[model samples]
Target: MRYGMAIDTKKCVGCSDCVVACQTENNVPHGYSRDWIAETVEGTYPDLAMEIRSERCNHCDNTPCVRTCPTGASHVTEGGIVKVTHEECIGCGACIESCPYDARYFHPDGYVDKCTFCDHRVKNGQDPACVSVCPTHCMYFGDLDDPNSEVSKKVATRKTKVLAPEAGTKPQIFYLI
Candidate 1:
């Protein structure tokens, strides 16, 4: 099954709850964000507008991280989550540099780290930590291939965009742009 996210940028309040939830749930180290918000400034003065985007691993079907992992640590799960075998990781940081969106980061243990879409929770039949904790309900997670799922319906009815589509990564993540 293809998995992806539907993020409502307009509803996003720039709150960092999603970031903290991911870090806490995954035991991600302090000072490193597995997923986080980015702000872009536009207009000026009274007309200034801030765009908030919650970013993580896109879990691209054609993932560059998986391709560049020399030791074969990073790969896609059957559910479409980009996952890394921490023990097999050699702290090479190839994945970090490969991400076109600057989504990946180096963990304290030197392994490349990014969002797993909370595979641990998904495996347990739960939503991703970030999606579960989002107060504004800005994030939606579900099987992208299922026509009845919210994610699939939203992508079908609305125009959505992913970061760096030019990379040809075929990212499953979508934004309600």
Candidate 2:
């Protein structure tokens, strides 16, 4: 099963609840974040359009991070969740440099870290911390391979876009506009 997420940009309020929840649930360092809110405003004055989205690792099907890792630390797990095995990571930063989304970060403990879609939680049939704590309920996560899954349905039925699609990573996260 390929896991994925569909985030409704229109529904997101840029409150950053998802970012805080990801940090708290993942025990990420105080200065670092696994996910963040990105806002883009276009047009002029009253005609301006704003889009706010929670961004993180795309868990790409064609992962440059996994390919660039010298130590094989960066890898895709079941459900296409890209993860770094801290013990195997050599703090080389290859994966960080390869990620088009700028999702990977060098940890204080000398390892690379990023979002996992909260794989531990997903394995237990729970949503990712970011998805679960979104006050607007704009985030939907599930197996993308399952046509009936919420994430799959949302992507199929909505005008959605993936980050850096030209990079051809085949990113799993969809931003529903």
Candidate 3:
């Protein structure tokens, strides 16, 4: 099944709670983050509209990072989650350059790092760290292939947008605006 996430922009409050939770759950290093809040302000003065989005790896189906990895360190799993095998990574930086979202980062340990969609928790039948800790309950994660899943239902009913659709990555994450 294809796993994915649906985030409601209207419900997000620009709080960085998801960011902190992700770092804590994944043991992300200092001066780095697996996810972050992106603030976009439109218009001017009293007419200004602000959109706060929690952003992370899109986990694209046609992942450029995976394709650029020489050692097969970056690969897609059976469930369609993109993962990097640190042991096999050569730290060549090819994957970093190819990523459209600039999501992957060079780790101090000599490897590329990015979001794993909390595979550890998902394998244990739990939601991803960010989703579990979000106070607004704006995030939904599940198999997109399953019509019964909340993520799938949201995509079907809501006016959602995927980041950089022209990039041709076919990102799994959908934003409900």
Most accurate candidate by TM-score: 2
* Model 1 bad stretches (over 4 Å): 44-49
| Candidate 2 Cα errors over 4 Å, as ranges | none
lDDT of 2 by residue, 1-177 (tens): 999999999899999999999999999999899999899999999999989999999999999999999989888999899999999999988888888889999999999999999999998999999999989999999999999999999999999999999999999999999
On lDDT, the candidate that comes out on top is 2
lDDT by residue (55-151, candidate 3, tens digit) is: 9999999999888889999999878999999999989999989988899899888999999999999999899999999999999999999999999
Each model's lDDT: 0.87, 0.94, 0.93
Clashing pairs in model 3, backbone N/Cα/C closer than 3 A: none
- How many backbone collisions does model 2 have? 0
RMSD of each: 1.4, 0.7, 0.9
Off by over 4 Å in 3: none
Better candidate by lDDT, 1 or 2: 2
Two-way lDDT contest, 2 vs 3, winner: 2
Angstrom error at residue 64, model 2: 0.3
Question: What TM-score, over all chains together, does every model reach?
Answer: 0.93, 0.98, 0.97
Kindly report the root-mean-square deviation of model 2 from the true structure over all alpha carbons.
0.7
